[model samples]
Target: MPTEISSPIQGSLVAIVTPMHADGALDLEALKKLIDWHVVSGTAAIVIVGTTGESPTVDVDEHALLIKTTVEHAAGRIKVIAGTGANSTKEAISLAAYAKSVGADASLSVVPYYNKPTQEGLYQHFRAIAEAVDLPVILYNVPGRTVADMATATTLRLAEVPGIVGIKDATGDVARGSDLIRRLRLLEKGSGKRFGIYSGNDDSALALMAMGSDGVISVTANVAPKLMADMCRLALAGDFAGARAVNDTLMPLHFDLFVEANPIPAKWVLARMGRCNAKTRLPMTPLSARFEPVLEAAMRHAALL
Candidate 1:
């Protein structure tokens, strides 16, 4: 079995974008540069090939290569959480196993998309993956995209599963997130095992963390890494006032990055900053020109411009 993941994986884990050239080819060189930048910029972890990274568009081989390349490139300087999710269970297992082979620290397995599995189905789906591989798994529940939402009870149930370490709750419902945290704390008191709850929605991250979430799986962190990192640090350290000050600066970016579908705006901003090309695969397009001024103003508000 793979070694157990360490407790308390927390802070600004950037749901990083996969850099692509104008022709939509994977930009491996640019990826390496981004990893180095994250390390220096104090990003707590790198979540590669996630929704923000356009996971659906990449083929299986491309997915494996991205995970492998990121783990290799990070080179122990940062933790790489490979986005090894798939709507298919077997496929998710295969990708997760590949992530394990390539030495990723953990796997962020999203709730199955499109199929709309029942809660029991969701439980078995995630459990099967955890049982099938030794890799530590973090459950991602973003019903907005996945359609199938995992309930807090189901999440608590999965907390009992060994190797299922934490969850990224993207429902953007703070009441739900805070309630889950309360229940998880109760469970920890009884079972002596820790279960981390991370906010997957950037706009509500500060509130969630302040309400006792572990940290954020942030989309905004892709562009504003240092500021995001600092905010998360302050939030986790229980300095909500300081964290709020930083978060206030980032609030505009938190909302605008999702002005289009996830990565479109994120990639555009990265290109503007000269970090990477703004190209994305089909079904996902470049940011619409109409939204540029809106995004640019947000960037300026965040001092990223």
Candidate 2:
């Protein structure tokens, strides 16, 4: 079996929402406040400009600014993982280089979307980015959103490459996760290299961690940072019963946050909690009125309301 990897970034790394004004401008003040809240709430790290942050809508300049601003405002109080992935490997390289220049601790690069590359294509795409940039790259494999999935073999191949440290498996298949863990253990035994595996699916995070994954890059953590962090700590320590108890309370938040497309519901919950405005870019609309009460009930269930 693989020995522990001692990952620097673990636990509830919130894929945080980018706070926006009613006019759809970036709300740096609200973003800073949210970061402060995460730090005090024991969140492990902050993932900015991610899908939850609407990276698809934000222009390149805005994307760079968000990453730079987050790293600066965070001021070493917490680790900032910039969502620098792009469909084009060249674009991703540029963004990741910028992330490195701005002092971000790491970069989360998602699988190439829309183009639907083959496993070999996927390998070259990520390898090019890793070679172009010096920072640690966390591969994000969320085929549901990205359309192109990185298979376990491709992931293991990439794991051997220097500068590629870990992955966020959002496949939500426990069997697949378990198999990957088994394979990684064998690889680690021979190479003695530490590889971190984090769950991208919030609802399945406890199960994944119990199977020896490192942590979660969570959407639910955006609203329930303290509970999510505590749950991860418990789960990592092999306290499944304790983790399950915390996960039970958060189960509602986990399910409801996806009631609408991601940040829509997440933004609404944050606004309801007086954290940020419920504004998102065009293409991505606000949470529907009907889901408001449902989300409210969920928040109440988690004692966040």
Clash totals in order: 0, 0
| Root-mean-square deviation of candidate 2 | 2.7
Error of 2 at 79 (Å): 0.7
Tell me the tens digit of each residue's lDDT in model 2 across 1-305. 21123454778899999999999999999999999999999999999999999999999999999999999999999999999998899999999999999999889999999999999999999988888888889899999999998999999999888778889999989899889978987897887778888999999899889888889999999999999999999998899999999999999999999998989999999999999999999888878899999999999999998
Error of 1 at 93 (Å): 0.8
User: Could you tell me which residue pairs clash in candidate 1?
Assistant: none
lDDT of 2 at 226: 97
Candidate 2, superposed: residue stretches over 4 Å from native: 1-6
lDDT of 2: 0.91
